[model samples]
Target: MTALLSRPGRVAAAFSPAHIGRAATLALHDELALAPKPGLVSFEDTGSHDDMDAHTFMRSLLALRSYFTHMAELGAAFAPFDALERSGIEAEARMLAATGGINTHRGAIFMLGLLCAAAGATQADGLALSADHWRAALQQHWGAALQARCARASVLSGGRAARQYGLRSASEEAALGLPVLFECAVPAWRAAQARGLSGQRLQLQVFFQIMAELDDCNIAHRGGLEGLAFARTEAQRFLMNGGATRTEALTDAREIHAAFVARRLSPGGCADTLSAVCLLHRLGALG
Candidate 1:
């Protein structure tokens, strides 16, 4: 008998890209504009400020990080999925997964996001997507041109990746009090580089506290913002344990992050708990 650890995948050749026309892109934009997540609480009609306007309970942190990273790595990843050579690209994405370099769970999530984006370019079907059929999300696009691209991808890859990781539907961002996006690169990356920044403990601590607040909101309600909060708080604790220098700013910042961590909004198991503690040792959030 084969061990479960060495079992074969139920699905094969999970995701691949298909040629989509110009209209597909437009349809994708429409989907972004119209897609909604069920069980969303306290929504803001406007798409402004990711901080307070989105729903996030069913959200997967690993998925969102890939979403951000895929946007970051589009140049490297897009080649395979390009319309001209999608078959080759799809093969490559699969190969990358086989090599264990690509994150299997996240890779699927990335495809779902792209496929969903493509689906938005069409009005092919009027079928509202449930969690299961989101890979076939084109039905909900009202039969737009983007649905054609989605259909193509579905036909080629059988929508395995889309179906596998199409767990959360995108919705309007929540802006509890913060802005839509947190460009950590500003003070955290670029600014530090320019300043030849060495001392970051305090700043890192403050950022952690901010994240804690965000996570608190997520626990109170359900939204995508929790991931960022989780990442931030973890980063803070790791910094604290590192024995960072005590400066006026640094001390104050550390206090804030520490305070947030001290307040437990939800119960976390080893993974979440350890991660929260792990981050304080780092100099700042990213580094």
Candidate 2:
């Protein structure tokens, strides 16, 4: 069992809707606070985005505060995916209203929300809060439904682009148990922490690692296949050269940020994945 839930009394409190929801919100906040992010928003400045910024993301986070809590509540009741889907739809509406129709956390509402639900369900089942257990809970409870949803067509631009480019959509990633998060991003985070890195350096290491790997439908939508390839290559080169450990790592990252912004490219999917890693770390799922 994880330390958070090792005690009997602590389990209920740990699994509370408010606590779980707060963790989800804080994870997004952590992601937003990371600077020198390639083609992403931060408290310092907006990168490659005129439609949204730190303020817009804050509004969306505030609006979503209750939605994640509600999802956990539903999961504790073992509610079906249809119920969760309805809740997500409602939450998305609230987010749009808060951000004036800007889609800042749309992907997060799907990815992190599901993780929160699974965390609730896992705790309710008296299981460990490890990544393995949470993942199992998600698959056991919602895998079939998610797979069915994945097979359907998406009218969204990102989804359309994924289809056009023969890349895996976010829906497909979720249905397959979020391999990028579980298989790639989490490991990168663990490796960074193991190297005794802290704060923004650790975050930068993981973010660049994700950017190098994630197929990022957002990149495809904005920059197309060529753009996606360029982004992957740049991110990979950053890691190969020295990543965040180098003395001039921040400068190099800022340069990459400038390049991405110049091309109007934003790796939103990678950003969402980074937020997922934050959530997992907060939940004690990242040893």
Candidate 3:
């Protein structure tokens, strides 16, 4: 709710690399703190996986604390795509070491890291910290590289599933400036705030919206195409039934969580997208 830099002010100094990096880290925390996230790990429970818990996420967060800030600094300098990619690769190595080889935030490391860089680049250009400016900076700086990257074969499970199912890979989403994050998730967050919603309820609504829209490779990798479809349908159904406004909303969400865990369907992409929403919120871009 506090914005150090917004459209009217455009305070470049306020959008420092450390500030952006801290925001990105806190955004990941915000995402991790959300409970009943439907097959994702949380403080109250590990929704699906036996391999990870909240402590693992905490270690990952600790490892990634400075990565985003560094990325932002690189972006402010107008560094090339290869530089950002190298930074990300190094950060991923730290994350893996921290989590003891568990992939706690691989998707977020790529997505949010880019956005953090884009935000810094936008600030360097004297642009407002609005979603549009950040996204444009991303496209202007690394759009072509991301597009080219999408064409390469990926050995990662999520990427392989995306390729096999003909779904849009994360690289494709990045090349196109993360349409779901900007077009869908950000708007949904604003709409929820406009509806007198706040706190976890607000986050839940936005999370469901992203889940309903994203072709989550994690879900596909675990549950295949059918699992992906099921997750989306369930998310849509949650939203249709009054979303977080329902009197029994938490109970309903928990039920959905149980179902997803039973099938091992974690909508990791949606979780990453929600973290992006949190980053924008922290940056004062949502207002």
Model 2 per-residue lDDT tens digits across residues 181-200? 98899899999989888889
lDDT of 1 by residue, 26-81 (tens): 22222222211111111323121222222231122322332322321232132223
Question: Alpha-carbon error at 236 in model 2, in Å?
Answer: 0.6
Give each model's whole-structure lDDT: 0.28, 0.90, 0.92
Q: Clashes in model 3: which pairs?
A: none
lDDT of 3 by residue, 64-183 (tens): 989999999899898999999999999999999999999999999999999999988888777878999889999999899989998899999999999899999898899999999999
Best by TM-score: 3
Error of 1 at 11 (Å): 38
Candidate 3 segments whose C-alpha is farther than 4 A from its true place: 1-11
Most accurate candidate by lDDT: 3
- Provide C-alpha RMSD values for all models, in order: 18.9, 2.5, 2.5
All candidates in order of lDDT, best leading: 3, 2, 1
Using Cα atoms with residue i matched to residue i, what is each candidate's TM-score against the true structure?
A: 0.25, 0.95, 0.96
User: Candidate 1: deviation at residue 223, Å?
Assistant: 12
Q: What C-alpha lDDT, on a 0 to 100 scale, does residue 251 get in candidate 3? A: 94
TM for candidate 3 is 0.96
